[model samples]
Target: ASPQSGYTLAVLNVGAPAAGMNAAVRSTVRIGLIHGHRMLAVHDGFEGLAYGKVRPPGIKGGETPQEVEGTPRCRGHPPRGIFHPPRTLPKKYFEEISTNISNFGIHGLIIIGGFEAFTGSLELMEGRAKYEELCIPLCVIPATVSNNVPGSDFSIGADTALNTITTTCDRIKQSAAGTKRRVFIIETMGGFCGYLATMAGLAAGADAAYIYEEHFNIHDLQ
Candidate 1:
């Protein structure tokens, strides 16, 4: 069935947390609500849905998604994460998450994260038969420091995380400069994408980077 009016949507994080995850969650929630959809924040990535409940660490619960701020507003420091512990649901609710289409009136899911999010969304999309009575719309926003998600070159936190890597490298480089013949090998997280390592190396003026995009060659560094 097609999605009807006022469809309830759930927002999920699919992988490792990064700088702008909270912002994405906040934005999706606010905008989804403005579009007349009911929004439910699914905490702790897929685990939350699998486990049925999670503690919303820094997030305030009682506030509806419509009330969330869509605009970027800095309130001192942004929250590190939105997960804590102890928010419980009925046992074996993961089964319900997969099959109970109309249980919470959830007909839409907006996932934010990297390849994991993309893959998971596809599985859910493929499993549409499980919820034959509802039109479950699934969308994913790439959000990883890896920036490895195929559709977009720039993921949600990629830019910010790259900047951080460069900034940290700059500080470390400064320290390395004070010492004689000391080279610092800074590591970054990008699995196989290497976007972070390549860009951060360039941004920080590093001598070279061992990235997956190119063959490993010590001569390249030389």
Candidate 2:
């Protein structure tokens, strides 16, 4: 018997924040919706998935109160509720998330994050298989300052971190006096490749920059 075709897949981004995190989410949602797939966003990191922090639109509302103290008499509006994800994610949160997805019939997942976060995705994939339930397709999007993920020229947050470093270095150079000898070491997040470190160092006129891609001999400085 031929297998029945499943519904179009939805994406779930499970990772840390980069400058373009929201942009990626928006794009994914738009594309998925265009293709007739239901879009769902997973809050926080993998912990969000594990603890069942999955939310849909209209689930919560805004923080500001609808009625103001000094408000004038205009048209009356309904009170809007505030949206909040689950608090106190526990170590075994993934188990809970997996159970929830299984029960709720979730079919697709998209994970976005650094190397550590990818590990969580792997775990979730394995969980999906072990339960003998419907298998969900998982996609991973790299988003780390380290730029260590192979096969990709750019990660999500690298550009933003690089810009911040350049600005800070420029300020330091302007404040230095001719008579004063100043040494500054600016450390940014790059677990492996050091792409952000190298770019920022060069743009900021750093004398030397060290990265995982190329080795730096400490004895040369001596």
Candidate 3:
């Protein structure tokens, strides 16, 4: 390997953040370490990596891995200076991210997110041949309430959002039940997907719910 940077299994999410992200990160790190692989936390998705665009310098100090505040961080490393935002930079300004996975002995990558995540996974899998000298396997984890990712029927954040919506609806029902014959017309979230509204309605035993998937009518309750 590339003189052993003392790390293994680089991971990051390129899509929007979800509620289960930190939890997934925790599990991924603890498990990878237990399995004898050191972990590197690539913050801010591919953008964080865009900075790594420049050929990564030779693996330096801290061959010994250590933990700080329940999270492992490299010691004796100076903080990075200010740089341009990820989006604002032109192709000319972008640094060339080092592509030396085999040298680092990285065996696999774990990606977490929704639809965007799926696309990123495909990109990595497709570029396996040209991107690195060694082939790296990839695992994609779904983490969103939208539950719209292909090939998977469910996602991590769906349950969390379901619980929250159910509880809130229950509270609203309790507080406003006192008003007799008062038809409560509560507006719910979930722009294109109606899973949230449908589940909240079922969990809360709501008298009615207007979801986007199935035709909903206001006159039904009457």
Candidate 4:
């Protein structure tokens, strides 16, 4: 569509912060702009959307896509408890978000973050029947170190997290090898999924790694 008749698209970051989030947001905004759409960003995720915290892409006045993409951390994230699974939020919450969508003239939404991002998109999709403003198209981009989002083999930040863990573990092993016999129990974050710990164990040559997905006992550890 022509720029004059282009749709308005907004992007939101939900759930916990993760590496590579800024790059994802930058790509979304740039892609939308390239397609002649009016691209806006919703700060603070759904809470921001409910409160009309919509604005043009950068956080600072002089920021550009190049700066945004080069950043190492996420720009922002919704606070915990601000979002729940689909159909679990109160009716008024949906109403407030819908009001902001109408006010912003948003035609589509792109959510970037972890599992919460997925659930938030689902909630918006299911709310379409009750709120016309929510009928707009939605997209979810997985951007968590956890790598726990279902159906996605890999999340945006998972690789970076794994590499960091492997490097650190290598350093730790080197140190241990030079000293008296000692053992270390390392923990990696992956929410309920064991992907990080499991994969990192294989990559780092850990004696054993545990994840929430698997059940174990004292004998198993022994």
Candidate closest to the true structure, highest lDDT: 4
Whole-structure CA lDDT of model 1: 0.65
Give per-model TM-scores.
0.75, 0.69, 0.67, 0.83
lDDT of residue 31 for candidate 3: 60
**Per-candidate clashes, comma-separated:** 2, 6, 4, 0
Off by over 4 Å in 2: 1-15, 58-95, 177-179, 212-222
Q: TM-score of predicted model 3?
A: 0.67
Model 4 spans with C-alpha error above 4 angstroms: 59-92
lDDT of each residue in 119-219, candidate 3, tens digit only:
76666555545555325667778877777778898887788888888888888888787888677766665656787887788888987677778775757
- List model 4 lDDT by residue over 1-222, tens digit each: 335446998887787767777768778876766567788877667877787778887534444433333111222433432332121222457999998989989999888888888877777778889999898988888988999887788889899999999999999998888888577878888878899999999999999998898987768765
lDDT of each: 0.65, 0.57, 0.57, 0.76
Higher-lDDT candidate of 3 and 4: 4
10 residues in a row with least lDDT, candidate 1: 83-92
List ranges where model 3 is wrong by over 4 Å.
Answer: 1-7, 53-105, 128-135, 180-182, 187-191, 215-222
lDDT of 1 by residue, 6-77 (tens): 677777666666678778878887666557666676655555665443222233454454346532222233
Between candidates 1 and 3, name the one with more favorable TM-score.
Answer: 1
The sequence of per-residue lDDT tens digits that candidate 2 reaches over residues 1-222 is 223334544344443445665556556654555455555555544555555556542212432212111100111222322222122222355567767677556787766656655666566556555554425677767766666656567788787888888898888788764447666667767767677887888898888887777776767544
Worst lDDT 10-window in candidate 3: 82-91
Model 2 weakest 10-residue run by lDDT: 66-75
